[model samples]
Target chain A: MTSAFALSDHDSAQLPLATELIAVIVASSGGAARILTIGGGDRLPSGPLESRHRSLQSGLRAWVEAQTRHQLGYMEQLYTFADPDRTGSAPNVRVISVSYLGLTRESQKASFSDAGWRDWYRYFPWEDHRAGAPPLIAAAIAPRLSAWAHGATTAALRRERRQRADITFGLNGHRWNEELALHRYELMFEAGLVEEAHRAGADLRERAGLFGRPMVHDHRRILATGIARLRAKIKYRPVVFELMPDEFTLFQLQQTVESLSGRLLHKQNFRRFIEQQQLVEETGDIATETGGRPAKLFRFRREVRIERAIGGTKLPTPRS
Target chain B: MTSAFALSDHDSAQLPLATELIAVIVASSGGAARILTIGGGDRLPSGPLESRHRSLQSGLRAWVEAQTRHQLGYMEQLYTFADPDRTGSAPNVRVISVSYLGLTRESQKASFSDAGWRDWYRYFPWEDHRAGAPPLIAAAIAPRLSAWAHGATTAALRRERRQRADITFGLNGHRWNEELALHRYELMFEAGLVEEAHRAGADLRERAGLFGRPMVHDHRRILATGIARLRAKIKYRPVVFELMPDEFTLFQLQQTVESLSGRLLHKQNFRRFIEQQQLVEETGDIATETGGRPAKLFRFRREVRIERAIGGTKLPTPRS
Candidate 1:
């Protein structure tokens, strides 16, 4: 039995533990969902939690703002990742990364030369179903995943693996669930179909590109977590407003949601659902920039945030 | 601007930052939701993340099972609290507490002499609405909260305070939201209505008793977080089955959900909603233990966990 305080001279107390705050700042623009990234779109803007920072959230905001020069809005803690092998840090030095998801309006070029907003789908192309599930899934992912599933030791294990693949990737008659972004990434990683898996010694470098572009360290995984969180959250919370401009046409609003969710929404159903919730109100103005007939502009009702705690706004995605 | 690597001599790296894992293991029995507690029901079972522990969750489970001699089921990370002043540790030390919410069947007597299960409502009397709003809110809490709201310096500040209070506590025609358990607790703490607030130097020792029993340190706050998470989760996720026995009647299931949610559910609507989800199956047995009539026993369909990631089970609580 191990004692609770069994400090073996190399425990966390003796070893230096660095707390890192990573930000996943998201925005929607030009019919695409984007994320602010540093290091030439390879890593998220992150910094060590310093002594001067009053709280974890403040530390994250400071780090992101300093690096990107883009003010974050509607931030929430996503998750804390502290697996010892996750960062591949020195054995004695542990890194605990607390990640946060921040939403904002359209992106501007960051102050730092390398810091810029990149289309989120660029990293996970298969995730986007706005134009139907990208061809990469059928062309590359399914065959590799099927082989991986059949490679399992026992028939029961093979069945379990195949089922998991079907559920995560929407294969074998399963519906593509936008909320399973993280699960899909994880499954691909397990199947050695992604670059991270190859980097982790899976010996499948050739199969990486079709899956998605990989980021430095675990930034891609963190992004997947952020994507999944936002995808799930927008179905219930009014957080999508944080990423919207002051006013937008119904088409623009629907486009933004579809971009983030990686799936096309039924236009009439989406507008009806939004109207039924009373989450938005007509601005009594029309937008001529929508390219065809002038459409009435709408702004989110900020008062709904106070009136209802949950403020649920169900997305009307057509049943697949 | 402070550099990202601005680490002072007394920063987290040099200072011994103790990583603590706290568990809010919950169950429902005898028409009440109960939580497992140690130190005579004043403290949750917690232990430091030790060197032998492979992961944060494993460390939590190991500590809890060792301390209480009870197995945990269906565990999920609740939140990680890491405010430097949260634990009031020494100037050189910091504490990072990662809390988890676990659900299991009704509690048995724990091996530890002081460990036992206590009704969750004992610590949050105002939270329960199963018998409608408790009288303590009107008799004691309202006046004190009103005074706190009015005590703010400026008129605008006072109005803001009052509005926040009303929104959080469901005052002035606002519908009572069971998921705001943490918000309510925090509001009371800020208003100096809870004993822990008094401990933090708010001179309100006399009014503490009416609020609810207070736990040591920030355990009560953590418990509130757990309660809030569970209440919110049960609406979207079929997690209530984790707290049920192998076989149970629909009435028992509703009671268990009500106990955890602190609100009564509409019987017919709740049963209908459950049936629509198809999350449970009849056990082909009748339970005569249900007082008047023989009730059919049902068990949760565990396979739904694999098929649907977020198998939603909406509790049909009549609108207030």
Candidate 2:
């Protein structure tokens, strides 16, 4: 390491301070990224930290099932912090958020009436470009955003605003990255396209499809944060394993990626990436035909896992 | 997103009639992951989620800071509702944990005598293999673990335990993944190398090493969750930007990754990763050199943030 802690003029100082946690729960089905929803709000299942708990996961598990009534199969910690001077709820109180990204096989449907679940894409309609991106990118968002860009008082500000929109929404022919989920949300929020911004007025809120479903408070922002993290994560680590069944077909796997990304991939390149990576193993089982001849079934190879670090699996996801 | 929500023929619904949350905090200098402590306990900052608050993160922020004066920065949601059964804590009372991951710059040193922060590696010394992994791995761990594997009563149980240990600790010649922060902790807990479970018997606890520091409740475990998440995250996204000042040199950027990951990356590879990914832009500035060449100071390329999603970046680390 460039500078080990032992040699960094460091101290074993402890801060008996407050911290916060959050959760990002995602499951996939029907070629779409689905987040477990509660009470019609697209919030990931979350709660508060307590002294009585034995561990963080234990606390997270309790929170998830209490609302959803289903045990979480795969769970991992996301991020942590104490936001300085965050006002609105408790007076003069400090808040911390510890977030988690959860993945599970969707076996339970919404049972009770009050409790509800929805497709993540429904909230972020523009994310779905599986059918080659919607016309809104060129026709609607660009024109309105162009006006917004010109509205900037200074040239530097205008250029910055234009660049932000272009990179985030992939205007000017940049490849759309499925991973910029959080950036995309923030960009829309900045442009007053989302409902959260009271500044948007009713017209933009109703017409701006670029803005996703409005969330309670920052829940949507938090969801976007999780999506951004997950989008970047699946490329290097075997985290996709958490979202998959023990045994599944490549098509199902690819569909899950597309769903979370809200964009389509070059099929041939994707297959080549999977095959070359040796990420999966032939299970000696075959699935009934979906299109062409019956395809072979495969399971994640447990050994290739230890052979490399975060990446070695050449995922040939073409930008074209 | 095949079939948004899959309904199983068998209906088994689990409901969380109650809620809870936890916070995982980290402050790093050089490259060491910092752990939060309470009453001298190596634990995560935490509290219960109650109706007294308006939003989840807000509630968490309030509780944590109420105890510690330190304000947090760069917080993200970790995980949600972890425990399914209310059996771990109080009976018949449902709970949910909206865990969060937090980062602090640590501008001020810890003043509280009873509360403190410590290097995360001190607890998991073997994790920091920067100058080649600590000898404890093969010398102390492998042999004892083999006996534990053999200690299982049934043959199948023995195999299961052995497989788990191997995968977790990378025993019998397995490559270690620093990102498996939680897995390493869970493995230590299982192996009885951690102080939490072994302290009941003095010898076991002592042998665990500066091994695992005891956390108040499950806070340390929550910290582990945060460490693992951050380690994995730094690879793709520019989250390190959150922790950095407005402008910094490539060396400073590299040191941060080394500290958090506790593993070194090839320097050339790291620089190449930063350049090709276009994560940073030159600010027309240069920093005075301490030794070799004065490194060019660069600002995070806020515009190119979306580009990272299309491709992953490498860190300037010396590969182990």
Candidate 3:
């Protein structure tokens, strides 16, 4: 057991410290889900920890609001990363990046060039299964993952890799769990299929069929973490409204949920589930732009939030 | 948005860094729940983060093992507190206390003199509703809480405080949620009923009847967080075995669950719930320690953990 003084030999008063903020600001627009991005959509909206900020959450909110001029609707601290290797800068510098998941109503608040929204799937192509596992999984990911698993040196290691690939990628007749966005991404990175796994040694030209557009530095990993949290959270909480407008048709609501969860829900079952939960109420208005027929508009019933903390959104479980 | 370099104009490299480890080691013995404590049972066993530790968890494990000579099992990070006020050491010192919740089988590993476990109910008497609401609530707590709620200057504030008390403490006919250990503590603190609320002022002699045994600093708050997490987690995960011996009777198991949750579960319903979950397997052993009749002993099924991530213990929800 080390005393406070023994733990720090340097007067216990001064040490090099740095704190960074990372935000996975997500929104839904035009039936497609997008994430707030900077630097040509290669990095998540992030900034330095300023002294002016009151707390970690405030610092993250300030950074996001300044960039997009959109007030963060729902925000929660996701995780704190402090590994020196994750900093992606000087080796000696100690940087702590506190990541957050923020959701807001879709808005054209920022320009297309600077800080703007990009399709989240563009960075996580394998996560979207709305179109039946997205041909990319079979055409590209599966073969590369199988090869990577087989390329392991020892038999035991090869068997381990194969099992991991099967579980994470939902291969070998396993049910594809839509909530495993981070796990799948991590598996790809571990197999050296993602660009992040080859940051140091980029000599592999065979990476063509593998990598999703890489973020600046593990930002995509953080984004996947946010996506996983959102997917799991929406099932138990009425957080999907954070991505929807003031009033939306059931089809639009279903699309937004499908866009985020990467799974198409059964329309009749979803409608029944929604009605039973009483999470939304008809707004007495109609949306004429449905392209089929005018649909009734509904707004989230905020009063239900006060009745219980664990209100379920009642999104149907994905049928594999 | 502040640039990383621009945000650190005042020689940010020289900022003082301090890392503290707070442990919420819990156990059950003598049909009562306990938490590991040091410093005359006023505070949890904690230490400054040492460089020798490979990681935060290792540091916490090392500290606990050294102090109690008991090996920790089922450890998980509860929460991280970075607020300077939470440190209660120095205003300028940047202290990040990453609290962890550790479960160890109830053991005679440490004497009652040094680092020992104390009944968790001592710090949270009102939380226990096993034999119905504690008399302390109606006798000591309810009147004081009512007075506090009425003392609010504005009517809206009074109504808000009363409503919060109702939800947290299950007043005004609201069902007592056994999982809201943290919320109840916070409400008590906010109402200035707990000792932590009167840190600066000593003039309130009336506060003698209002306080729980005060911990050294924010340790009680940390414990509340751990309790809240455990209460919520036990429903979804089979973590209770960490507190049990290798094999135990169903009654003993039920007692442990009741002790930790601070709520009495229906015997037949709890048995049915446990049996349906298949979280445990009969050990083909009978314990004659039962006062009435010999009871079948069971051990946790470790294989269930690998089979699925979201295994439920299915302890009957408290009939409030």
Candidate 4:
């Protein structure tokens, strides 16, 4: 009878103790959302869990600061990956990778020359539908996904795969849900359309560059998780400010949100919604950076953070 | 110079090897929701993570079944607590406690003699406002919490604590938020009004029974987490069916939700919302069991689970 309260073996000598931290530090720069990458933009910033650290969050904070020299502002634990297959082909080894999502303003000062930021859309071309659906979706990816679905051994499997592709990628006239970033990535991987899938034993050599850039060792998937979290979080929380400057024009603010969400907002309706929410207040400063007339600069009203659980910001959808 | 991929010590012999599983098995019995417990109802049914199990979820499922002989239907990983202090007074010991929230129909046959179901409200009396505020909150808890806040070392500290109390417990004209179960429990714990606080070296002996019953360890806190998750989930997930019987009147379904959320739903509005969502369908059978009149029996339309992301059910607010 195995009781839920049985004590661990006093010997503690046989435990497989391998743990690491994967950081997904995100920011918005020049109307494009980017993620910080180490190893010359090929990998996410990561490190082992040092025993000397007080807690998981602190461990990640220290490791990231040491590597990039930029402090993380808003951070949350994303997910923990402990699957044996995630740690490569090592069968006997157990490795737990705790991933985190961090937000910070895009830095103007250079700290580490080795690490640089890459636009997130570069790795997920189909996600940005601000200017309408990317041509690659209908021209290339959709046809391949249809082929893969048709190639399934069973009719039921084919149907299921097709439905999954349709729902996740918003194919067949389905409306795209921006929050399904991770789902879309996983679906492409399962269909052997992404580069990472090829590395995982899928014969997808021909489909390599066709399916966006790949990161080293599942880092792209972690970025997708971060993106999905941020996209969903901005709807309810004022976390988007973490990516904004201390003061900026309403146009800049709207552009920042658009760049991150990968969707265009109706200009008039966006301003109306922002004004009603009072998420920001006029700073009495004007910015002439816009090629046209000066726009009022505004700062986030920090007090609103504590006043109430602010409702989600409504995105003004373009008229169909 | 730490990399996210740095490997742990190769010896693996000196690693602190402590792992435990905390279960929050929930069910709805009668009009009240209950959680399963073992050890004469002092602790949540828990055990060590055995090496023989293939995965964490499987380990938990096997252990839970072996103990209660009941099969779980729906399960999700809640959170992982790795704080060493959570493993009791042991210094230098590292015990990682992984908590899970499980949903299943109330068992028809008795399994474990030592384990049984208990109403969740027994440990959270102040949370249920279905019949207006629980009298004990006004009669006892509020005054005690006020005293604790006043006793703070500094006026700023006192004000902050008071604000926290007001926001968490819905005191001082604040509206009650049913989803803040964990926040309320944590506030009580911090104020030292709960028994667990005294164990944590708080000098709060006088205000003991004024709060609800305390569990052996932080099991009550974990239970609070489960309650919070379930309350938030039912709004979007249609998981309430896991707690209900196969065929029930709309009133019975409403009662189950009310019981779990610890609040009253505006009856007519609740029905309207359910109908609009098409969450349930009539079975063409009459349920005379509803007492006064024969109400129609309905079963959940399970297809809606996968068709769309269901919106939260709006609880009809009482006219103040």
Candidate 5:
């Protein structure tokens, strides 16, 4: 056990460290997934972890509510970002940003002047595949990625780069994996295609808006992490209920999941799986809002939270 | 868009903060799961994050290797502990411990004098259920937990506490959830049944030995967190291979998984599931060590790491 308690003078005289709390509050509505953003939709709600804060999570919730005027619920720590190269802070100071993902409904509009919910697809134009893979993936992303792969110094390096690009972006017979949201964004960042790459001294001014709208600092990267986590989490956990209404038709539930995952599901298969899992129960009410036949409303069974804690809920997502 | 950059003089005059990197290195051998411990099995190998460390992960690997001389192969960030109450640091200094879970084989012996691998069940006796639920649950834990529940002030509070105890410890027909290791430890802590609770002003000096041996400064809690994470991860990820030898029989693989999960797996069903997943391939060798019959050896298919990255590997453990 090396003692962290006894620090030498040199080790003790470390750089001034600051902790930042950032939130990626997500909501789904009208067949689209949205994230809460501020500063004219350029930054996530964030604040410094002050001395008065008791814990990391409480501080995050406080900061997010204060900045957006919307109380966060169903939040979990996403990741802690501490790499000095990613922060772009002052030279003498080190910044640690702890980001969180919060799931909520879009009913309560944020009261802050600049805080608003923006469609998540607007930031990642190539992610949405509900209607089919977005054209931007083929028209813009693939060509640049190929060029980046071929530009490697050696053939081995070029092959490795090409394989990585193919695996990440699901190109040339590779299946498109919706959960690789972070991987795709990271590959683009490495290929110097995103605006953040340009900000970090990459020569990509010509392809500024081709990738996606970049957030301040590494907030976009954090958002990508949140998206990837949520996409993967939904398959094993009953967390999608966090973004759902109290009582909703099965169609609305499927649509919300599809919107968040950026992929469509077979309607019959989705309904059958949900029924088999017994994750939801009939509300004894009907939703007549559908222009077609009225659909039965259902509520997420709360008991599953306790019962399925060990045997986790499994969503049957068809392979692409 | 609340700025984490600007800091007031008062906020800047905050307590001196130190970041500690802790590794919960895990391995399975001889039908038992073990963890690498230092300081006579009372402390996990940990060190303060130094300025020269490139990233949080790098700092962790360097610190663990320096302390134990064991090279880490596969690792992931478990959780970052920043709650002030959890760390018993100096009055004016805040210690933030970022813990990681590392999976490795038990082939290399740690070179340090105090460093040794201890069976995980020694610290979490009630967690093991290979043969049956450990007697410690009914004999020691349940009665104390029930008393704690009834000790609550109001009827509603008491009912809630009882329900919580029942759910957490699997009392009165509730199923034992192997992944709730941390929750069980925390409940015991709250009930003042553990030695650490006594150290923190709880009157549990008499019942100290009843619960498992306590580690120094929340290390045991961190270990429980690691156990819970690994148990859950192994169900959905092919990470057990990180703790296995190059070649082994199917029975060995099942034993390794059962040891880590603290539960028994059906032999035929486990083999069938593994074969269906295509996670392993025949190495064209035979293990003659087993006296009864020579069994075929197999190696984990490396390609599954990429192919199953999106659709994770699932283990079919029988319901308790």
Candidate 6:
């Protein structure tokens, strides 16, 4: 059994030694945008850093193959960090982790035995802005959060609470910027309305209910991290290609972006930007069978890839 | 003695065992954009995941505070991944890690016995677009990378190599996008021109002398991660506030954004965007005497922060 309070501040300071990786794999599925997860958990495919690996990229591919067995379409290193105390009970144990985000087609959604896939919006229900803010956001959360903000003792404190609440959960005519996923999650967590709190022996289920369902461990929070990165990414990079199929109608691609970003795009402008940037070349093939008018199929130009590969392959971030 | 083998295929099936957090802390020091580093290494701060920790944010704050003692502002989890065989000899051991990015105003630099700060431009010399790309870009790197690209034996490979080099290093009638910081570093690293390899087993004199001295470990690589993130960040979020003092002139703020992003902004367009967004408010203050017109001081609108905490801050992503 673990020692009583084996994690004193001094001892606690020495834990968390393992280094790992997390990836956010996004794709369109069932006409709805979905994020990839392993074993129904919000975690993306990840593994540890090993010295045997030639470089970080190779090591990442090896682990990814071993777990999912599907070839990765595209991958990039997101970031890396280390734990001072080493999460293991051993003292001076340090682990270094490097994380990557990968993209694959939903056709490869084959599940791994210990893995499962869940919708990203399940964890961040408020993020689905396609149809506008869900009613629960206004009727359930707004008023409750307002009450909580007013619960502060002094006027200044009350104002500060209101400001924080309003910012984290867009209030008083402030437009909800879908990208503050992590901050919004943190605010809910601090308020003791997250599942991790119950695991940690604190209870804020009543408040947590206003947010959304929490995940096992830090999974929900990690999902927020990936969503924020992806939301910010779609604006400037051609990374949307990774989530797209080889042959896609421009509208299909546009909807995918709109779906993940939780914001609708102006069709003409979106089409004009994509065309001007030369992100896609017309396949000369049209898909008229499924829709009103035939839309041309476009293949991601593997050429602009050269110039935009680093900064991005897209022009005009999705600005309304 | 440490264990000899820590990785096996079966060992890989289990989820990553350790979670690590790497942080890219950026600040302006002495008129130059600088990156924070630790342990006399190349770049950034990092730590591990612990069961004792309440959540990822608290865990990261604990480790970061231990070193810098400065509370972080504007933090976002960057990525997470695990490498089971990171230790080389250890085979069965696995680790998981979560990475994060932190932004803060430069203060009294922390005193890490082995750590020091370096100007970010020193690493990617070509990125300094404050005055636009210097002649050195064409004179120094273009020819070398061009030759290397054409050095491939097969025609197919040669053309690819050429294209990759041209776009990555901005060669042959290409515009330089400052956002490709990581691409630039990786390209140079592969070319064996940077000082980092020389610090390893590679010889110093034989190195291509591309740009900048190298850090002791993978610090340069981590530095690239930070650079790429900042370059992408400036385009969307109001994170520039983190680098600014409590109050500042709009011009000073623009300079900071341009400095980190390595791109010049159309002053009129930038000001218009700022004003229209309602992201800032006059502080009823003014400053003058820099041999130019006196300017009003403004603090970020604490309220509109509720409006665009995520993608509210716009980046002048060049469509030009």
Candidate 4: list runs displaced more than 4 Å: A1-14, A108-113, A153-155, A308-320, B10-17, B108-113, B151-158, B309-320
| Chain B TM-score in each of the candidates | 0.93, 0.82, 0.92, 0.93, 0.95, 0.83
TM for every model, in the order presented, reads 0.93, 0.70, 0.88, 0.91, 0.92, 0.76
Task: Looking only at chain A, give the TM-score of model 1 against the true structure.
Answer: 0.94
Q: Using TM-score as the measure, name the better of candidate 1 and candidate 6.
A: 1
State the lDDT at A263 in candidate 1. 83
Candidate 1, residues A1-320: lDDT per residue as tens digits?
A: 55433443444444456677888999998789999988788889888776667778888888887887778778898888677777755665556778899999845654465678889998999999988888889988898889999999999789878888898888889878888899888998888777887676655485445667788888899999999999999987888888889999989988898889988888888888889888899999999987789999999886676544442456786634
Which ranking of candidates, highest lDDT first? Answer: 5, 1, 3, 4, 2, 6
**For model 4, what is the error of residue B19's alpha carbon versus the real structure, in angstroms, after optimal superposition?**
2.6
Model 2: how far is A36 from its true place, Å? 7.2
lDDT of 5 at A248: 95
Badly placed stretches (over 4 Å) of model 5 are: A1-9, A153-160, A276-285, A301-311, A318-320, B8-15, B302-304, B308-311
Compared with the true structure, what per-residue lDDT tens digits does model 4 show for residues B71-116?
Answer: 7888887766666577574666555667789998877475575777
Could you give candidate 3's per-residue lDDT for residues A98-215 as a string of tens digits?
7899989767666544678889898888888888888888888889889998898999778777776777778888778787788889888887778887887677644543457887
Per-model C-alpha lDDT, please?
0.81, 0.66, 0.78, 0.77, 0.83, 0.65
TM-score of chain A of 3: 0.92
Mark the 10 consecutive residues where model 5 chain B has the least summed lDDT.
B6-15
Interface RMSD of each: 3.4, 13.1, 4.0, 3.9, 3.7, 10.8
Tell me the DockQ of each model, to 2 decimals.
Answer: 0.40, 0.08, 0.31, 0.37, 0.42, 0.25
User: In model 2, which regions exceed 4 Å deviation?
Assistant: A1-120, A148-161, A189-253, A276-279, A283-294, A297-314, B1-71, B79-100, B109-117, B199-204, B207-210, B241-252, B275-312
TM-score: which is higher, 2 or 3? 3
